[model samples]
Target: MNITSHHGDDQVRIALTGELDMATTEQLRAHLDHTLISRPRLVLVDLDGVTFCDSTGISALVAARTAAAAAGSHLQVVNAHGITAKTMQITGVLEFLTTPPGH
Candidate 1:
């Protein structure tokens, strides 16, 4: 997976591409671990380019959100569709991570 992040308005927007599986989950985990240290107000994970997602990937998202909340930051997943969205839905992760900002 290719993970890139941008910082703006006291938030970090992380963009992800490629497959999100066990092979690439560590990279995301490490990236998120590093980002959470700064305690940004918002941490957005954009899965616009992600072509696939597995259980491990879903777990990482949950863990990241948990860590972010513990760090006093808000974490949300956005732009997830296609197979990735289907996988998240199948695993019941869509409800956990895909909530919009206000609701």
Candidate 2:
């Protein structure tokens, strides 16, 4: 997987592409750690480009959400479609990470 990040004000937006699985989870976590050092007010993960995600990816996302909450920031997942959206719903993690309409 590839992760590209952009920052504005107190928010950080991360665009993820490719597959997120066991092999890529660590890389994603590392990126999240680096981004959190800036103490962003919000972290938005754009998953529109992500083609696949396994359980490991889901765990990483949950961990990111927990970290953001602990830092008094918000975490959101954006532009998720197809199986990714379905997996998030089936796993119940979407309730915590979903972006609001119009975001």
Candidate 3:
């Protein structure tokens, strides 16, 4: 998977494209690690372009949210549709990640 990021005033947005599996989970993790170092108020991961996601990918996402929380920041999984959405739902993180900030 290809991961790109944009640093905003209050939020850091990471966009993912292609499949997110074992082969690509590390890439996402690295990006999240790097991004979290900056301690942005919020991290928004855009999964609209992600075509597939396996358990590893789901774990990476959960890890990201955990990291953000530890840093006193927030992580939001955005535009999760199709298989990606279903995967997040099954993994039991979609609701937490999609919930509005401060909710």
Candidate 4:
């Protein structure tokens, strides 16, 4: 997977592309760790380009939420489509990552 990050004031937006699985989870974790250190007010993960995600990827996302919370920030996921959104919904993790209806 490839990740592109943009920061504005206290918010950070991360755009992810490709597959997020065991092979790429660590890379995502490392990047998130670094980003959390900035103590951003919000972290938006744009999954529009992510073509695939496995359980490992889900775990990474959960971990990011935990990290963001510990850093006194919030994490929101956007553009999750198809199986990605379904998996998240079924796993009950969507409640934490969702941006609410009109957000």
RMSD in Å for all candidates: 1.0, 2.4, 0.9, 2.2
Superior by lDDT: candidate 1 or candidate 4: 1
Model 1 lDDT, full chain set:
0.93
Question: Model 3, 1-103: lDDT tens per residue?
Answer: 7889998897999999999999999988888999999899999999999999899988888888989999988999999999889988988888987875798
Instruction: Write one digit per residue (lDDT tens) for candidate 2, span 5-80.
Output: 9999999999999998899999999999888887889899999999988889999999998898788777888988
Tell me each candidate's TM-score. Answer: 0.95, 0.92, 0.95, 0.92
Candidate 4 matches the true fold with a TM-score of: 0.92
Across 1-103, the per-residue lDDT of candidate 4 in tens digits comes to 8999999988999999999899999999999999999898999999999888889999999989888888898888899998888889988887778763235
Pull out the clashing pairs in model 1.
Answer: none
Clashes of 3: 0
- Each candidate's clash count: 0, 0, 0, 0
Structure candidate 3, residue pairs in collision: none
| Collision pairs in model 2 | none
